[model samples]
Target: MARLIDLSIDSDQVIQHLKHEVKLKTVYQSILCKQIIEKASQERGITVEPEEVQAEADQFRYDHKLESASQTLEWLEDNLLTPDDWEAGIYDQLLKKKLADSLFGKQIEAYFAQSKVQYEQAVLYRILVPYSALAQEIFYQVEEEEISFFEAAHLYNIDEYRRLACGFEGKVSRWQLKPDVAAYVFGAHPREVIGPIQSGHDFELLMVEEFIPAELTNDVRQQISSQLFDEWLESELNHLVYSQ
Candidate 1:
């Protein structure tokens, strides 16, 4: 029997597949977001120059280790994208970035200043267990130097994968913690042990290592930009839906 070669799928087939997989809503939202960016950027005269798109594409290719044109083409083939499709994607991303900066760049510093306290970070080691009695036992053991926080977490934490991490939740911000837990952890001094407190189903014992004062670092700037852009996008999307 002869073999069938390289079957092709059309846009309608792709849409049908998305619907079948119950992913049409997610794909639809993404398409709407792209349309929003294109329209809004054009209105604001936020054009993404060819040079900018080329630079972005080069950076992307470098990031993905696609060093040569052949390697890039192979990658595009693997990802089911043609050169034009990939270039258009890079252009779309650059346009969105320019639009986001134009709309929210001036407001980031003010927003960061307002939310500075929420960005304060803490380094803590934790031991969490199912019961309070065991937690109290571990607390005393740790307090008296009979056992270390790391050792207790290694031995007793029920979540095996998290046992490693519970021993070191590196640089968690105030926003990341529950309000009650944040209050205790932030108030405690360095090297202080606090908790065996009720955390939903588990009792958690935390040992604070250090506190990091919030600063407007580059990472935080990028975070704020993304955050503000997402908020704007969601609001625009909601308005569009409601008006329709």
Candidate 2:
């Protein structure tokens, strides 16, 4: 024979709140995503300072017009989250970003060092002649070197931007050009005609008018560093997320 046990009754309001149901699997996954973030954050020696959290929370509240953090928590809970979950998400994001910075920060400096000449500012004159009978005629004139690139551009180019600057497209980076274009622009002796180059549906002629090498400008290094960090973060995050 077994003995029966009785449980105490709670107030109706308490019972109603307690009855709020959430999916077991969702709760479990939320816990897992939370743990991953915490572990990653700890590995990086990052602390989500109170002021920072508060600032984020304050902004969240202001954006959503929520009364307080507590309300925010309740809303999150209703959407299947806890405060821990939110904090973990934030921690993971910040820590991942920081780790990326630490990892890729040096590479950016190296990149800037090696590619400084490639980022040199230049004034270019270009003529875009459609693939037609006129193309060979224009190409011949430019190739003969009898007429200057500027003269050819003024005579035959139809692109309005070229017309305005007397065919000058100022301050371009070699990396910004297509592989073929970069080769031509950087490989040529300065002031030489570079192309009857195929570009999309047209043929182009280009000449480098002037070039200014990239100086060690303020914040340029930082900008490159930040970009590198972002790239690293994306790669790392992709690995992490896909690994599981």
Candidate 3:
């Protein structure tokens, strides 16, 4: 034990700070979730092999560029974690991953098939301006190729962040947009400019970069699995609370 900075704290202070930070409820929920996961995993015999944990730990160290044993030890010390604690954390993560897959891996395909449309994604560019006239002007400029969409966006977009991004909205899911707006964006073909769309006090011009039709991707599968696991956890937690 070496001190980076001298600190004084107690269990009561930690609890008080957690409460003040509005994190006590979240902390309780997370602890309860781990307990529930532990029981469920044991029941199903979903366990993480030591080798798997070691592999993950190796990857983690590499990702963080902890190139040597000393560096790895220093990193753990900086995070206030012992080697055992790090191994345990890795074990817990691996266990939850195994448990998630064991429970929901086979169900992902059918669930995806049942909810295909929800997975449709679009890559888009947009220019949002305060005036319909300005939006329409920008739209024709884009359509006629007098100026590029990205140029128009950077020059005229109202949002500072969007202006810098040239209005690039990455891989937008259908649910992320308003119904009327989504219809126009999703139905339009690639490179088709789809608005001067009136939205409250603002008007927006949209262009579809590409449409990624619903398909099962590895990332999508992982996402669906995590979603299923979370829903199951929430339901279990609710039932546990209600029973109590």
Show where candidate 3 strays beyond 4 Å.
Answer: 1-4, 128-137, 140-146, 158-162, 175-180, 196-204
**lDDT (Cα, tens digit) per residue for candidate 2, span 1-244:** 1112354434554445445654554555545655554565578686667667667766777888888667887778655566777776665666655654655656766788877866666667788878756666776776787776777777777887786565777767775787778888877777877777888888887888776678656455666666676554456556766797
lDDT of each: 0.88, 0.68, 0.90
lDDT of 3 by residue, 110-131 (tens): 9999988878999988888999
| TM-score, every prediction | 0.86, 0.52, 0.86
Off by over 4 Å in 1: 1-10, 128-133, 158-166, 197-203
Candidate numbers, best lDDT first, in rank order: 3, 1, 2
lDDT over C-alpha atoms for residue 162 of model 1: 61
Q: What is the lDDT of residue 194 in candidate 3?
A: 88
Q: Which pairs in model 3 have colliding backbones?
A: none
Tell how far residue 104 is off in model 3, in angstroms.
Answer: 1.1
Model 2, residue 36: what's the lDDT?
Answer: 54
TM-score of predicted structure 3: 0.86
What C-alpha RMSD separates each model from the true structure?
3.5, 13.6, 2.9
